[model samples]
Target: REQADLQRVFPDLYMNSLSNVLTQGMNRKKKHEVEALAAVVSWIARSVGANTVVDVGAGQGYLAQVLSFEYQLSVIAIDACSHHGRITNARAERIKKHYAAKMHKSRSEDRNLNMPKTVTCRVLSTDTFKTLSDSLLQKDDLQKANLTGKGVGEHSLEGLPDGNVPSCCVDSKPSLLLAGLHACGDLSVTMLRTFLECKDVKAVVSIGCCYNLLSEEVENADSQCGFPMSKGIKSAGLSLGKSSRDLACQSAERWRCLGKDAGLHNFELHAFRAAFQMVLFRYYPEILITSPAIGRQGKALRRQHHQRILESTLHHEESAHSSPSLSQKNCKKKGSCPTMNSAEAGTAKNKGTFEIPLSDTGNSTPKSCGAADFASSILEMDALFRGVSFNQSTKCEATKSVDKYSLFEKFSRSGLCRLGLHHLQDINFAGLWKETEPFAELIGPYWSLRAALGPVLETILLLDRLLFLQEQGNSLEAVMIPIFDPTLSPRNVALIAKKI
Candidate 1:
């Protein structure tokens, strides 16, 4: 059908090039998946004899482009990505060229039988729905406001007549709709809801990914889902299931167990080491030298690196205290003597008098350290020591925690405390759990509930599709095939309406 349509709609020049290039530069693996799904959908479409198809979340338009060109079906491809839409549009244009060439070739053999080759392919952004809807309503309001000599204000359209609304000329009912290869979060949900609301959308096929970004609860009351949606369910009200939640919980527990098994003494250090290792593996795959083979061989190098880092940090600390600044000298001249080292400075306040060694000035008087100067010097020393300690500790713990679980725990606990989980008191399980509860409350159950509901909401939307078709006087025979996927876990569940 697509080939026939292409022959009629495209010019000779473009069609020839499109057909020639169609087979070129195609990835066999990806094309096979497309072909497999397309074959199933196309067969069903043909059996149903549906002429129009809308592909929702149609990334790059590969599936829609193929269907439009090959089946001569009118295709509307919608996606959120502008670049993806453009790519699809470009592909459609090429398909048009390919069809035109076929028509030209066939013209010589058959003058009487002309193919009606008008295949309309529209690449649309998801926002196009809102924009189009708004423009339609606005146009009617402007016309009414014009008669009253009151120019339409942005807010003025609130009172427009329903009849004056602009209608999208595209069929209110389409034969088939597809959301092929939809991405993370709400995109899949949006497509499913679109299927439910659009009465003309007869059939839908969708593949969804990125389960993590979905919202657990509907913050926006005016949202399409209507009910309070959790993170798992799509905006359309599809819930994934309890099993998904169980799996997620298990995965998290496994991660925690892994951390514990590493024998990290500090919970803070263990957590940091685990996270750092994951990130390092992801971003710096080459730097991962901790495999059994390398770990055994690189022991000397690792030790040397560790020593060098320690030496550098100690040098930095020494340099910080070696020279007294001009302010310190001025304080000294004002009879505010410097404290002798940190230990002496710490003990001087309790003693009530701080003794300071003065340069030999041939005078019999000994300089005494003022309380204020002693306190200030102690604070400065403490700040310097803490800063150096934290930096060095974090780096060391991140690198070596895997080998020494005790060190990992210390670092992880300290890190967690900074993040506001203070319960990691002694790196034990009890302390870890106590510290983790608040943090868990902030991000855990809420997100888990949201993720688990995704498949459920999908199921609901799919049922809604079936119900919509039934209301339209179409039996299950005509509409059910496209929406069914055996591979989906929650199979055999159908939408059944009861008298209650």
Candidate 2:
């Protein structure tokens, strides 16, 4: 479809406004990115001849509204974030009213029974996948909604038919499954795997985000099983390796080069900020402070606010540094700090010679480690953070061998963890999950960050698995489509299988 056609179909007026806002500062040519995305969505819809489309991360339900209203296709928009989901639901209600009014005015009768039912928008977090699915499978409201072209009222999926699968529209299992725009960490992966596991889901179109959150495990079911394999075949399914960050780094490098070419010193800063903004929005919900009068804040005030944040963080670091324990002294004595040397101390005669006494209550002097091993661990962490490229085999080994307690010990002693903050152990993952739980509840949804990350990592690792599926004499009825947009970093790569 053409740009005008796509615009006519899009339901979210706010998203249209956002497109305009995003384009305001960009160059004329670059301003077409949103338009291009809309066009791509329209093209995919037409290509699949989809009668019903469900967007997994349907923020604001812009695309869902448009598809339902414009193409006359039933749409189900789902999101883990309750705030966004509520906004989308409200927008859909507004559009439904508008459409009903327009039909009455134009004297056009609502003719078709299957002509797009009221868009079913739900606030569903990705974290509670199994729970949500199980609840959905038992819900009667959804079953009635599916059979009749009516919407499910305020109800859980407790009595819905086939609610075991996330998508309610897949009863007869439509020929097409669509997830247009999705977000970081795990959401994107969940969509791809959902498509893979659900038999009625014939085609999938998805875009993914958040590479680092993906699981390192290779044997996940979602990643291994693309099509319906026999019980024996399923068990024998091969494992896909770890998700690679090479593509993400490549994108970063390109941005860096672009910045250098333009003589911009802080190109990487801007790039990093843009990348971090997505993470902060998804993981740290508090960072999004939406004030109605925020636009009125002056440049000076904004700068002051930024400075205050930086200063506050620095102050916290300083406070943490002032208190030193016995372990810290031993860490220092081990010569972990490259700058501290015997020769430098000798030259600076007035320098204080601080020593910890060998006592219990006053803190006993801790034993020191061999200088070599301490230095080696430090170097290893440094190397990991340096973004050095490593092959999948080597990378997996390195990650598995890394000791969490030692890293925590190092962090506790030197406070370097507070400074660099690069190493991400299993405990860090656990803590992140714990932290995200309350936020998920605040948003009125249950989305497991780990489950989402696992599937996406599975999808990336299973790029080869798709190739294997094709190689194993599975007919070319389904084509693997890796959705990669140069403008936006590749979030997801989906395999679309069509029944020829």
Candidate 3:
């Protein structure tokens, strides 16, 4: 209910001290997530007296391996992706072999190098949400388990070598701890519902990610829904739009690495695209009929433009007689270089600048006609579009109408097939620059403020799931805990609930 660090919530669980051989190779992010989630699940298992764990969306069986091998718990890892099951099975075998080798060395007397049934990977035929009830423990599965055996008993490895392990279901109700590490979208919600419906599931530790993939209740069935689980929030009509949900999934660590300048560049890039759209609108009035989805294509275009600009600046500075090699040397040494400012760019004669006029007037004035470099840039842009096999008719029209978009129009139209370009027809370099300067200055802080509120959004979503659990009446107590270091894993909070 209140803010608490992950360590504060699970103090008993410690990191696994893996020897060199047993240290399975994984990236730093994965290593941290596995260690932290293992600890939390270990703690939850102990608290609930649960030995069997059901891991949904178990990619490569990393968490399952931790629970079964490290924590000495029985685990069934389920994923809809069949390919992942093969990888999981392979990893599980490797870990088992490593453990066996270690055990054989320590105790030469015991020849029973039989693998532990620490974990089993299963490919789910049903949807991820239906996995709990439809694909639970079977009778044959219980037989394979040797469930009656004492602590740390050897589990059968009969069918694992070929990756054909059957789903194990218990006839009598057995205690279960359901877990999902970064279960995307509706999968996490499914786990919450499973804990409520299935009495055997004693506790749950769900850490969700990819909020953008979540289905809106109004648009989807109750079974398929991912948001507005709590009655309070549901009654208040709370909803996170696609963009907001996508924003919620952003990592703070990545933001810190980008710093202020790169972030601002990205913001300014959007306005540039918007202005470019206006240019297209003037030439092609048809573009205004609908709103086209530019999406990441605009970002890519902006990045290319930015890169071209940098190259141009470096080239110009390098060719100058006085500062012939100064710019090049400085850029190479310090990874920093002077770039042409917008103010200077507007006045530069032979450099590529946004000096293209919106008017079709045949005036000889310099302001009415584009610079040679600008015209060349437009030609280069057009060549790039042609390289991608974009529609030639649209390209011809764009070129015939305006010299500025000679090549740029096809690139923009290829990505944004809708009508948004019409509005940008009137926006020119000077006016767009004037409009974007203030916006560019303020956007960084605005995005940061929005990012600061991400945790609150995460909290609300997790709490809603917890509230749903409480309302189920099966779970005695349901609470959300910060189970991982926030700096390491942005989506660190986990919803944990225990049965009566």
List per-prediction Cα lDDT, in the order shown: 0.38, 0.39, 0.57
Q: In model 3, what is the error at residue 246, expressed in angstroms?
A: 2.3
Residues 26-121, model 2: lDDT tens digits = 443333433344444555556656545566666555656555655455655655444655566566566666667667888875642112222233
Q: What is the alpha-carbon lDDT of model 3 when measured against the actual structure?
A: 0.57
lDDT of 2 at 299: 32
TM-score of 2: 0.43
lDDT of 2 at 114: 19
The stretch of ten residues in a row with the least summed lDDT in candidate 2 is 356-365
Q: lDDT of candidate 1 vs native?
A: 0.38
**Could you tell me the lDDT of residue 235 within candidate 2?**
57
The pairs that clash in candidate 3 are: 137-168, 137-169, 138-168, 138-169, 278-424, 278-425, 282-425, 287-419, 290-419, 382-407
By summed lDDT, the worst window of 10 consecutive residues in model 1 runs over 357-366
| Candidate structures ordered by lDDT, highest first | 3, 2, 1
TM-score of each: 0.38, 0.43, 0.61
Best model per TM-score? 3
lDDT, candidate 2, equals 0.39
